[model samples]
Target chain A: MTRIAVDAMSGDHGAPVAVEAVMASLRAHPDLEIIVVGDADALNKEIARHRKADVGDRLTVQHAAEVVGMCESPARSLRQKKDSSMRVSINLVQQGSASACVSAGNTGALMATARFVLKTLAGIDRPAIVSPIPSRRGHTLMLDLGANAECTPEQLFQFAVMGAVLAEAVHSVDSPRVGLLNIGAEEMKGNVQIQQAGKLIGDSELNYIGFVEGDDIYIGDVDVVVCDGFVGNVALKTSEGLGKLIAQFLREEFSRNALTRTAALFAMPVLRAFRRRVDPRQYNGATFIGLQGTVIKSHGDADAVAFASAIDVARMEVEQQVPERIRTLLAHSLGE
Target chain B: MTRIAVDAMSGDHGAPVAVEAVMASLRAHPDLEIIVVGDADALNKEIARHRKADVGDRLTVQHAAEVVGMCESPARSLRQKKDSSMRVSINLVQQGSASACVSAGNTGALMATARFVLKTLAGIDRPAIVSPIPSRRGHTLMLDLGANAECTPEQLFQFAVMGAVLAEAVHSVDSPRVGLLNIGAEEMKGNVQIQQAGKLIGDSELNYIGFVEGDDIYIGDVDVVVCDGFVGNVALKTSEGLGKLIAQFLREEFSRNALTRTAALFAMPVLRAFRRRVDPRQYNGATFIGLQGTVIKSHGDADAVAFASAIDVARMEVEQQVPERIRTLLAHSLGE
Candidate 1:
């Protein structure tokens, strides 16, 4: 059985969403075991409310006295929230009781706690966030989403390595094509940092495919796109903004009058299919790569379905032994 | 009459597209005079083909012997292509024969040459590229699209001032709300540069609204969004890529089967309205702000209608006297 620890109380919706997601994930993954860490009484009540009392070993609750606020500072959370649910869940992973941990808590707190607890793997300076964004092909893995806002050229090279390993392990692609994200595709296009990183990556054994522009992120010519956390974060959030704007525009046009409303009804099926194809919830979980243990961060506002998808991602990472694979790849490629 | 010089060569489609756009703009605006600069014979042939021989002095052709290649290096273009159509068009603006100039040529070359020829306004470190992006409320003007890869705090502040001035002038808003683009909205969220830039903008006479994340760019909460050219460029190109991906997905869904094809037929009008609402062509032009003279850069692949939209932007900037207003604003705000 693949054992996973769930931080049951840190997200915007709190324990109920986490408990419901746990129930749904348990039902979906027959060989899965989940330990919900939070206020024991509230979690038990939630489990009872869901009528999941019959599950014996597959579902269990571990008491955690506190919860981390969604907006709390990472440093303060690390110092003050030692017994917090987010920390306890990660503790479960460090203690070998769980193969992985999933949290939709404060992102900064999660990264800090995960790094402090598991520590980065040998030769890894800092843990980087790697997440998949929808593209023309299946999807492309983009790294350093918001962790390590500023990075050295060597750090960018490390991110490239980690992203490539995760893409290969999760997607089962051999020698995945990696790309360095920049303002322009030409080598002479970006700033000094990007230009220098390009040289390091070019010298590596990975399947480096030169540089890629912002549009190339979705054009799906490369499987793993790498950049500093600052650029990646802005790019990701900008995409979110654009998606919302397009949806709002479509809503306005479809509701302009009775005739357009009728057209919307006729187009309902096609619209639904299109929405399903680009649904952000399906791509909810982002991994904290370079850490010694597997940690997946879900969207803080995730509902049961979205949280369940995150659990699915944690399960896959656990089965693939993502951290171990990354360590091995780093050693082999970087001769660490 | 506002006489504008149009670079009749240098775009992906070259003279034909520029000539057609000139004809369209002449028909749209009677008070507008356009000098098409390129190989005289080719431009004349295009004008004759459009049956616009009787445009009189409203539309004229200026002979230029050279055209800058779209992919040519900016430095090479500046050093070698002195008599290129792009340079000649800008020369017309500098010589007081044209109120402004528009080109769908190489962006780097355009910025380099325009800066070299027109020079930055007093108290401005670098010129920024500002363009309108669709937002919930009409649109938001964003700056530093790709002009300077790295920007100092002062440069960012200048971009904010310029963007605010353009928003007020072009959009007819008073004291437009300005924002510094950052990874997080919090004061302490971004890198050192952004953190310092926030302080600079907050202290300025302009209406600074604190830091905004990428989503706010399209949320329309702020009138002007400012960032370094690299980040801004990535955000803009990423939006373009996402737009294309969403359109491709929609097309696939609508062509899935006979039932969906019939649905698309029924929904054609609504779909067209939505497409038109978010169409990039309507927002085709980006201004080179902070320069002494007004210059507009259109997309290289722009069609006749899109090019005409760029011409409309040029006309608006000419009427608004954007560069002169920026100069006055900077003088007052920065005490230069």
Candidate 2:
């Protein structure tokens, strides 16, 4: 049984959403265990209000005094708020009481606290935030999603290895195809850093393809894409913005007049299928890779459904021993 | 009457598409004159096939013996192919025979030829590819779209002024809201370059917002977004790929079964509206800003209708004196 710790008070909806997600998750996975870290009083009320008589003792509550606000500085908040739920959740894993941790709070704070508590892997300089986005194939894992704004070429090479490990262990691909994100596909296109990173990745044992542009990320043919945090973050956010805009435009267009309204009835099924394909909740969890232990960060505005998905991701990460495999891959590839 | 030079031999479909676009554009704008540059034998044949009896002598043909392939190195191609259609179109603009030049050839070659033929404005160090993207507020103009891989804070500042000039002259916004694209919206979030750029923008006379993330580009609230060519190119290509992927998914979903297929009949209007809303053709022409003369770069795969759109863009750009306005704005803002 894998035990995962939850930051009960960190998400936009706070204890109620986390508590409901935990209940739903526990009822679904019989052998799964979870530690809910938050204010004991608030969490108990939520758990008591929701947990049924048939509920198991697999779900437990851990008390945390303070809460980290969504906008707080990662370093300042983690230092001042010693007993914040976000910190406590990472502490549970560091103490070996939980196999993995999930947080839907301030991303910067979570990364800072997780790195401070768990530290990076032996050979890894800094941990990368790897998130799965829906693509034409199944999903593509994009790394350095606002973790380190600037990275060295060697760091990008490390990201390729770490991303490959997760793709293999979690996604079960035989040999994942990794791509380096650049302005253009041509080898001579990007700056010195990307060219250097390309050489390092090519020399490695990983199945490194040449450079890929932004659109290649959604084509979904490749399994992993490596980029610096700055570019990765921009691409991710731009996609979200575009998706929202398209949805808004569709909504406005479908409601323009009576003829369109009638057409909307017939378009419902296909629209629903389209929704499922591009659903933001389905792509909620972002795995923080290169750390000693597993940490998954969910969208701050995630509802119970999305938070539950993040929990599922954490469970999968721990069950698959993704971090251990990454360590092994790094040792095998980089270490002489 | 404004005369525009067309690179007739450059696009995917070559002279046929260009000739058709010229006829269509002439029908749309009675006062526009075009000088089609390519092999005299091929262009005259195409013009004879499509040119109607009522067509005025406003249409003319120029002969060029050589052509630049799409993938050839920009410098090498420009250096070797002196009489190429791409080069001759810019030469017409340089010789003051045409007000603007439009090309659908290789982007690198186009930029190289345009830069070599028409040097940048006095205060500008490099020319930026400024293009309008469909957004909530009609459109948002993004600059440095693969023009310069790297940009200094000052160059970004100049892009702001140039983009603002286009927004005011071409987009017709009196006071355009300009934003600096960054990983995060926070004041201290981005790297040193962005931070310094933010400082310069905030201090400048232009209407500057603090910071905008990738998603904000599609939000349509801001008028102009400035970034280095590398990030801008990635964002632009990613949007294009996602747009295509979503369209493909919609096609597959709407035709999955008999029921969905039947619903497609009713949903046709809405889908068409969606298409019109996100039509890639409407956003084709990329204005080469900061140059001494006007130049428009159309997509290589542009169809007749899309090529006509590029023609319309050239007409608007030349009539509005976009380059002159950019030069004036630069001299006013930074020249002193």
Candidate 3:
């Protein structure tokens, strides 16, 4: 049975909603065990509201009296707030009581806690955040999405290798093609760091497809696109904002006339399918790879359904042993 | 009267389209004089086809023997192609033969040639590329769109001042608020360089607002957003791609059925207005600020209409003397 720790005190909605999500996910996956880490009284109160009894031996609660504020300094929180729900959830993964940890807390705090508790794998210097970005064709896995703002060429190479390995294991793409994010398709068009990273990636064993532009991200030209966190974050947020703006614009256009509204009724199915394909909640969790244990970061504003989906993602990561696959990939490269 | 130099051989369509655009723009503004920079023979052939003899006085053909290839290295071409159209056009700006220079050739070549020929203002260490970005409300200006990949804190400060100055001169916004682009709106969220730049901007006199996220780029939360070229380029291109994608999606949605087609005919006026407001060609040129003379880089695929619009933009910049205003602003800081 897969056991995962959920930071019940995290996210914009706080403990009650998180507790509701944990209970809902538990009801859906009967074989899965969930250890909710937060204030015991509040979590139990919410759990009792949804669940009649213990339901199974699968449910457990761990008490952490404190909570980390979203705006607090991550380093300070990691050092001082040892009993915070965020910290305790990561501790569960560190002690192997739970196979993975899921949180909707401050991203920096989660990264700091996971790094401090679980520690980086032997060959990885810095971990990266991987988020599946929805495209016209399907979802594309992008890495270093927001974990490391500054990176060396070696770090990017490791990110590409890890991302490729994860895609191979999770998405089942054999020989996944890796592309460097750049301003243009030409080989010599980016900054010094990208140029150096391109050379390193080209020399590596991974299937490197020279360079891909920002437009190629939505076009699904490659399986893995790698960049530093700053650029990656900008791309992710810009794409998200554009998606919402476009949806809003279309809705405004469709409602402009009665005839268009009538036509919208017929086109609703196709439009809904398109909206579902690009829904942010469907791809909410960002995987923090390279740590000894799995940690998935849900969006701060994630609703109960989205948070439950994140828990499901954490369970899948634990069951698939993605960290081990990444470790093995790193080991092979080191041996080479 | 504003006399601008147009690189007839710069864009994809070359001389004929460029000349036609100049002719069209001249018809709108009869007082405008255009120096068509290219081979005299080819330009004469295109102009003769138009059958306008007296138009010669308003439009002068400046002879240049060579042209810079789009894929050519900027540094290499600057050294080798001294008599190229790109170089001659910039030389006109430097010599005051033309008030400003406009080109749709290689961006790097245009920047390099402009910098080499006109030189940066006394206080400016590096030049920046500034473009008007479409926003939900209207439009906002973003700086360092692609000029320099790496920028120091002081360079960022100067960029803010330059960007603000341009916005005031061109967009006519008094005391345009400047914002540093960061992953989060918090003070300490971005990389070390951005944090340092934040400190500098906060202390500067240029209506410095705090940090902004990528979502604010489209929401028009700040008048001027500053970032290094690496991040700025990703943001710009991602927005461009999304704009195109959204337009395509809307067209598909509106033409899905016969009823919607009838609605589209009535809503056509409003939709056209919206499209015109956000059209990429409407904001086609990017100015290379901090140079001694104004130089505008039009899109490589810019048609005759877009190229003519770029000339109008160049004329405005020259008429306003943007470089002089920037010099005045920087002199107090740099004592130039």
Docking class of 1: medium
Task: Give the per-residue lDDT digits (tens) of candidate 1, residues B165-218.
Answer: 899999998889998887761223447888898888887789999888899999
Rank by TM-score, descending? 2, 1, 3
Most lDDT-accurate candidate = 1
Across B171-237, the per-residue lDDT of candidate 3 in tens digits comes to: 8988898999878612244467888888877876678888877888777778999998768888888
Worst 10 residues of 1 chain A by lDDT: A182-191
Candidate 2 or 1, higher lDDT = 1
Candidate 3 CAPRI level: acceptable
- The Cα local distance difference test for each model comes to 0.90, 0.89, 0.83
Q: What is the TM-score of chain A alone in each candidate?
A: 0.97, 0.97, 0.94
lDDT of 3 at B271: 69
Error of 1 at A70 (Å): 0.9
Candidate 3 ranges with C-alpha deviation above 4 Å: A27-30, A51-55, A185-191, A247-271, B48-56, B185-190, B247-274, B334-336
Give me the TM-scores of chain B across the candidates.
0.97, 0.97, 0.93
The order of the candidates by DockQ, greatest first, is: 2, 1, 3
Candidate 2 stretches with Cα past 4 Å from truth are A53-55, A185-190, B185-190
lDDT of 3 by residue, A125-208 (tens): 988999887655566789888777788998998999899988888778888889998875122344688889988888877899
Q: Candidate 1 at residue A169, lDDT? A: 86
What's the best-to-worst order under lDDT? 1, 2, 3
Estimate TM-scores for all models: 0.98, 0.98, 0.92
Which candidate would rank higher by TM-score, 1 or 3? 1
